[model samples]
Target: MTTDTELKKEIAYNIRAALPKATSYEDYRKLVLALAESGDTTGDKTVSYINYTLLNNRRMKRWDKTLKITDEQMKGIKAFSGKVIWLVLTESWCGDAAHTIPAMNKIAELNPGIDLKILQRDEHPKLMDHFLTNGARSIPKLIMLDANSLEVKGEWGPRPAVAGKMVAHYKKEHGKLTAEFREELQNWYNKDKGQETFNELITLLALENVGNSANL
Candidate 1:
C-alpha cells in the first residue's frame, strides 16, 4: 500500500496539473446552468438522466441564499490560524455537489486562512480516486491542505454524516435510490438547513489542528 506521504506528493502533483481545469463556485454554477440549458445529464442512474439537470438547477438556487453559521461554528472557524487550501472535487451535474458546495463556499469565505478552489472530479481522476467514499467517486470532497507545505490536513465530503447514514439506511431498506427516494433526501436537507454539514466540517478542521500539533 502507498504511504500517506507518497500519496500526498502524488495527489499534489496531479492537482497542480489539474488545477487549471478547476473553477470558482460561481463558474461551476454557470456551468451547471449551461449544461441544463443544453439538456446534458450526469450520474450513472437512469433516473439521473432526467433529474440531474433539474436538481442541479434547483441546487443552484438553494446555494444562493445566505447560509446561517451558528455562533459556535463561527468561533471554531475563526480560531483556526493555519493557512489552508480547500481543494474541492466536484462536477456541475452532481446534485449533491450543488447542495453542498455553497455552504462550504460560505464557510471558506468567512476565514481568510482558508482558500477554496473547485476542481472537477472527472477531470482529476487521480486525486479524486484518493478520496473515494466507499470505493465510489463521491462529489464535493473538501480536501484541506497546508498552504505553505501543501500537505493534506484533512478531508470531508459528499454529504453530511447524518445524511450519509440516511442514504445508507435507504439503500439497505429500499435497495436503490428512486426518484421518490431522492425527493425524500432533499426534504431531509431542507429540514436540516446545512447545520450537520457545517458542524461535521468544523469537526474535521479541529481534528486536523490536533493532528498538526501531535506531529510537532
Candidate 2:
C-alpha cells in the first residue's frame, strides 16, 4: 500500500516521462479530455500511438512488470473510510480500454482499500446509459464512487468526446466532483499555458491526431 504521496509521485513521474508538452493545468486537462473522446468514438490512433511511442519505452513498460499487490500494503489503506470503489465499465476490444485498465490496475494495486469492479458497457447497458445518450454508450468508463452514498466521487471516459462532455455536463448539471484527486488533475491543468495542455488532452484520449469527435 503506497501512500497517496508516493502514488501521486509515481503518477507524476509517469506523466512527466510521457513528456506531454502540456505546461499548464488546463492545457493538460483538455489534452486528456480530447484523447478520451477520440479514442472512444473513432478508434482514433494518433494519441494512442504517441502514448505507445512515448511511454512504451522499455524502461517504462517495465513499470507494468513491476506492478504488484501485497496484503500488508493493501491493509495500510484502511484509513480511506470514503468507501472507495473503482467502476471500470469498458469493452474487451477497446484500445482505450486496454490503455486505461492497466493504469487502473496499477492504481488498484497501489491502493488496496479501493474496491474495483470491471463491467462491460454492452453487458451493462443500463449503467452505461446513465451517463450517455442518443444510443451513444461508449466504452472505457472509469468511475470512482462512494459506495455508502452510491455517489460518484470522480469519473472519466466513455473513451473520447461523450466522456469529456459527460464530465463537463455532470459538473454543470449536478455540480463538480469534489474529490481531492480530481482537484489535483485540475491543478495540473491550471499550471501551464494552453498548448501543452491541448496536446496532452488529445494524447490522453488515445487519438491525438488520428481522428476526433467529428467522426462520431
Candidate 3:
C-alpha cells in the first residue's frame, strides 16, 4: 500500500503533468461560452448536462460582472507574494463552479504571483482523486502549489464554509439535495455576492504563510 508521502508525491507529479494542459480563466470562460452556444458540455453530453451548461454560462457571466472584493480583502490578496499556481478542477455543467470560479479569477487578478489554472475534473482523474471532498468527486476544488517545486501548499474548494454546512445539513435531513434546494443555494450565492468565498480564500492564503515566505 502507498504511504501518505508517496501518495502526495504521486499527486504532485500528476499536477505537473496536468498543468500544461490547463486553461487560463479567460480561455476557460470562452470554452464554456462556446459550449453553451453549441448545446454541449465537458463530460457526458446529455440534455440535462447541456441545459446545465447553458445555465452555468449565464451564471458565470453574472458573477464575472458583479462579484466585488472588499478593500480589506483586496489588501489581503495583494499581500500574497509567493509564486503559486491555483489549479482548479471543474466542469462546464457545475453550478458551484459557476458561482465561485469568477470570484477566484477576481482574486487571482489582484496578485500577479497567483497563477490560476482551470482544468476539467474528468480529464485529470488522478489529480482529482487527491483533492476529493469527503471521498466524493467535487468540482471547483482549488489546489495551491508552490510554483518552483510543484509542492502542494494548500487547498480550498467546492463551496464556501457556510455553503458547505448548508449542504451537509440538507443532505443529513433529506439524504439528497432537491431541485428546490439547489435553487435556494444559488439564490444564497447571489445574496452573499462572493464575499464568503473571497473571505475563505484570503484565510487560506494567510494560513499558508505565503505572504512572508519568498519563493525559492
Best candidate according to TM-score: 3
Q: Which ten residues in a row have the lowest lDDT in candidate 1?
A: 41-50
**lDDT per model vs. reference:** 0.78, 0.45, 0.91
lDDT of 1 by residue, 31-63 (tens): 777777776754442555546766777776766
Worst 10-residue lDDT window, candidate 2: 19-28
- Per-candidate TM equals 0.86, 0.39, 0.96
Candidate 2 regions exceeding 4 Å error are: 1-63, 66-81, 133-135, 159-216
lDDT of 3 by residue, 1-216 (tens): 999989877987898899999999999999999999988999999998999999999999998999888899988997776778899999999999999999999999989889999999999998899888999998889998888888888899899999999999999999999999999999999999999999999888876664446434
What clash pairs does model 3 have? Answer: none
Candidate 2: count the clashes. Answer: 30
Question: Which model, 1 or 3, shows the larger TM-score?
Answer: 3
Judge candidate 1 against the unseen true structure and give its global Cα lDDT, from 0 to 1: 0.78
Off by over 4 Å in 3: 210-216
lDDT, candidate 3, residue 130? 89
Task: Give the poorly placed runs of model 1, Cα more than 4 Å off.
Answer: 1-6, 41-51, 211-216
